[model samples]
Target chain A: MSKNSSNPFTVPEGFFEEARSRAVAGASEVRRRRRNAGIALISGAAALAIVVAAGTMMRSRTAARLYDESAGWLASAEYDVFLANELIYENGMDY
Target chain B: MDRVDQRFEKIVQEYSEPLYWHIRRLVVSHEDAQDLLQDTLVTVYRKLWQLRDPSKEKAWLFRCATNVVNHFFRRKKRELGDRTLDEYLEQTLRDSEYVNYTEAAGVKLQKGLLTLTPQQRTVFTLRYYDELDYGEIARITGSKPETLKVSYHNAKEKLKKIIEEDE
Candidate 1:
């Protein structure tokens, strides 16, 4: 084994102490980054869940409205009024 | 402290010095070794849970340290293609705030080491200075023992030629 003096190189004094401090700091940083990553992953999953639920709800509601409109159109044989039944009313209720 | 935290602290305290020495030799810069060592420690912390067999901690730590050094050199090579490790040492000697081993013999030895490829240098240093066996080095470097033996032999021959040429 290479001795401290005879080796081609040597480190600065207090290197171990400095290394310990750096390791501690590094460990904390890793933990922090991991925590952030976990939070981001959870947030993404939650957002995706909300979006899927909203999409399903919207699809069902739109399907019911379309079914109602098409049925009325078939019964009345009026193309314009039948098409108007498919319209989603947000503010006005003329249809 | 938690069990994992306690284990981590113990690992940091026990392995940092040796790992620092190993890394400095590989990187050829104290500052870079310091940063790289910390980066390695962080990686170890992150992967602590993945260690199924805890008895291999020493080998695992050294392996991780070697990997960090390899990554550092890979990035450096990407940025500065075909640049030699001697050039890095010379630059450090010229402008470094704290490269202490600047003797002629030391520089000659280091430059002679630069004569080999980085993998050869690492393998030889682990064999010669660190006095590790081939099997241990193979595990640390993720290389076959036969390959490491060949590398070590070639490194020895090249180092001999370089030192002789320097003399």
Candidate 2:
């Protein structure tokens, strides 16, 4: 067990009022910063979600158009000779 | 004033000096101590809601103050400044006799305190200058009670030797 020091250090008078005011101000500042951070986080998340959704939609449309163009090209005369050749062979030497 | 307000006011009024003095001792300047004290109080104010028991508030505040001072010291180390008040006092006392017995005693104590590591200094100031119990000091410093006791003892013995050497 230890004894308390007889002469504990003393502070100058009237320091608490000053300290209290500063503290209140600091607390307010912290609260304000926290609120701002929350708002920024929410807005940032929303913006990211919007960008992702737009990107996904754009990618799907681009893919669908690519498929349509390829299908259209394959449906032309360039593909008919190959199919005709296959049929001639399958019909047992038909000309 | 309301109960909470009155109670806090009384606490601020009563403990302000000791806390300030403790801070001043740790930080070594009136201005730095003032800044740290404000920061400490602000933290206490924000966390006051967490303290369910009013009786523990004093200890809680002291603990917070200790942390605040430690943080200030670390910051200063990074910024690279002149020695704190403790250092300055130690240097001064080494040259001249204190003007009065009280100052002589204070200087004597301050010199030994200056020899401690920053963490040890924090423990010492909280225990001796602030008159906080080991448990309170532990709570404030985030150290186990036994560790704090060991730190406090080592600091005290060193201070005692330094003071005795001057005699």
Candidate 3:
């Protein structure tokens, strides 16, 4: 162990260049990360919109089906009552 | 693009080489050192606004770098099921390519450094390699100046003893 007073580490040639490149690369990487995050946000919004639209469409279809069925049932019920009244009138059973 | 961003880049360019060496000495591997240095700069970029007095940026940067190194060890510890930073230092000595201490003194000095606790190693590196004053180191390490002085004093004595023991 000789006089170990001076700094013991020695860097390679072009070390500064290498470090500079790293910082530049790091900055670019930051930009890339931000871009990816933005893309993720947009996709999330799109997914939410799709979910909302699908839910609305399903509700509309269900309401339409129920409306048609109820309308048909009402028409048949009205026809049945009319036939019963006519029969009563024809047979003279007015009571 | 803006003034702050411009200043940040200037800081990166100015400090990268020295910071790399500082990290290299501690981490003892090129890849790890490079990764840590970049991570440190990224943090600096994000947190430069916290630095109210721009003149004290160096100490702030060092503080950030130390935290990054500590964070790396913390992550590694969790991954390895509780490996200590001192143990990591001991294991990585064999992997350090930057240690060109083919000479006996350099080799002995490195061995002595590795033998120290993580805190002592950091204190020594800051004092000897970086030539930072105790007050500056205190600011970076968040330790009292008196405590840093004591640590530096003991670290120097231990290094000498270890080196001399080999002779």
Candidate 4:
């Protein structure tokens, strides 16, 4: 059998032309899908980064506020202790 | 079109018809062959960079086509539960579009070809129809040239007997 030998199969008229077009189109579609997927992956990574940054900022702000409140409470408590000592001393309650 | 797209378009123009015939002979359906050819070309586009040796490009395309056909039959087998590949092909030949039914000998030849094992069928078609040498067939099929020679011989004998018996 040779390449020119006839086989039983027959394609539709103009099938090869159509097949070439379809193949080119199909390859283009694959490239398009890959591009879309790459874009989506990058977008997803970016969105994740933004979410992480926002969460970190919010957490840091909350932490700073909590630290300020704790320091203020400590200062007031120290002043009260000092006042109590002064009252005791002023009240002649020292041993 | 960029360089890669231009290269791919050239490939599609060059190899589509031959690949289509190769796949049509194996699958025995124009629609299936078209779909498989498209898949093969798409695969070639995706993996073209992996082909280092331009001299082996034809063999590589055929190899891709052969893998696609194998995958098709595997998926078809799973879908067809207990119905053999032969049965499926027979049904496809009977009902598929774009087949030349007027050529009784050709149809009989295809049936005979289908009776061979998948390896023998592939080897025979690549050799007999595509006129590929044993080395090229071996490259496409990943078989030793001697092994392909034996398979092709066996397939030829079997098909001869089948066609003669039909006559």
Candidate 5:
């Protein structure tokens, strides 16, 4: 095949240089974005873990407090029943 | 830079002009060609590790370039709602910058090229201008060699008629 010697297109001065730099810079930008995304992913995971741990700790504390309150109420009721029985025996009103 | 970056730089320096012209002939605009070349190079840099055989670098590079050009056309087609790709390309040729109207024959040839379909134009340019063999083009374009030969023949016939009528 016969090759055509004439070219109709023209480029700006230093266009190749400019394009080369831009290409490299664009690759660098991609790398930077990937790195940033990875960092964000790790940070997100860490934050989620912290939140879960805090929630678990708070839930454990709440359960302990509820248990203590229930135990105290049961003890107070037993003490009141024992005192009422003693008063009845003292007054000879207990069969 | 590092070793990989150095290798990428070498690739850019070596293939930039050839790839630019390869893209320019298909896209018909300097700006679009430049952008596509840059995109191609950046892709090459990122995917350089995938290249197991260094012997196929040229074919791989051309493949990347073709893919980028195809994507550009697809996007333009979408943006140009209700209009065909041929019409959009014709408009682009009319309004494109960095073109030499002084080269009347060259300009005429480019116009004739635009008259052909995208596949025909690509096959013709790679075969006629870039002087790539049908096997290489087949690898780059992922088309059968017989198909490319037919496209090139048809493209040549069309361009010949267009040029003959213009004379």
Candidate 6:
């Protein structure tokens, strides 16, 4: 164990106090910066999430509309086929 | 009462001189050490929130100081390539007689420290000059206590050799 004084290194008294005050100020500045960055990130993330959700909803609504239109067209084709069969039966009977 | 101001005052009253002494030994320049010491405090204050345990504050402070010194070393390396630590210190060492124990040790210890590897020198400085325990040194330097033991021993041997040669 090297005695404390035996080891070379010394500093004036009160220097530590000055350094400490500086450190506290620096730390406060860092905290402020971190808080600002965190707020910006949160806001940015929330906006992105909202945009993605809206895009997904719009796409699903468009797909559902297309499906409804195809269903309506298919029903019209079925009605036409039924009417044509009835007409052919009546003509056969007359012949 | 402002908690931060009070905390800062308490810490300054407690560790500033010790930390200043430690940094002065490593860099071997009064002006540089003073600057680094200020930087160290700033780092400590900024990172103080990360310290969950109050008991570990001392160790944390020294860890920050070590990082500040390493940063200084890195900047020096970028500015002056291929310059040895000894050569750097020799060029920087002042010719006037040192007025105090701290100043005197600053020169002799830096000269002795040159004999050790960078890691060994750091270990020795933290352990001996700074009077940090093995565990504290380990925390500050990120070396295992067992590794610090080995490094300290190696550093002591090298320092003894260097000091003897000078004698």
Report fnat for all candidates as fractions from 0 to 1. Answer: 0.56, 0.23, 0.46, 0.77, 0.71, 0.40
In candidate 2 the C-alpha lDDT for residue A81 amounts to 75
TM-score of predicted chain B versus true chain B for each candidate = 0.86, 0.80, 0.91, 0.96, 0.94, 0.87
lDDT by residue for model 4 over B91-166, one digit each (tens)? 9888777767887778888888889999999999899888789999999988999999999999999988987787
Best by DockQ: 4
DockQ, every prediction? 0.33, 0.14, 0.26, 0.49, 0.45, 0.22
- Candidate 6 docks at the CAPRI level of incorrect
Q: How does the DockQ of candidate 3 come out?
A: 0.26
Question: Candidate 4, residues A1-95: lDDT per residue as tens digits?
Answer: 22343476777888889888888888889889999999999999999999999999999999999999988976897878877899898996653
Clashing pairs in 1: none
Model 1 lDDT, full chain set: 0.79
Q: Which docking band does candidate 2 fall into?
A: incorrect
lDDT winner, 3 or 4: 4
TM-score of candidate 3 relative to the true fold? 0.71
Error of 4 at B128 (Å): 1.7
Better of 1 and 3 by TM-score: 1
**What ranges in model 5 sit over 4 Å off?**
A1-4, A66-95, B81-83, B94-97
Q: Worst 10-residue stretch by lDDT in candidate 1 chain A?
A: A1-10
B107, model 3: CA deviation in Å? Answer: 2.4
Best by lDDT: 4
Q: Which candidate order results from sorting by DockQ in descending order?
A: 4, 5, 1, 3, 6, 2
Superposed by TM-score, candidate 5 places the C-alpha of residue B3 at a distance from the truth, in angstroms, of 4.1
Model 3 stretches with alpha carbons more than 4 Å out? A1-13, A35-95, B80-87
Give the per-residue lDDT of model 1 (tens digit) for B46-130.
8888777887777788888989988887788677767764686567654555554546566667667766887898898788866
Q: Write the per-residue lDDT of candidate 6 for residues A1-95, one digit (tens) a residue.
A: 23543544444566556666666566667768988999999999999999999999999999999999977876897867766787778775321
Model 6 segments more than 4 A misplaced: A1-18, A75-95, B1-13, B42-53, B95-106, B142-167
Q: Model 5 — interface RMS deviation?
A: 1.9
Off by over 4 Å in 1: A1-4, A8-13, A72-95, B1-3, B81-83, B90-108, B153-167
Please provide, for model 2 over B25-139, each residue's C-alpha lDDT reduced to its tens digit, 9 standing for 90 to 100: 7765556778888878777766776888777787888877887877776776666566664555454445432123355566557666778987799888887767789887777
In model 3, what is the error at residue B9, expressed in angstroms? 1.8
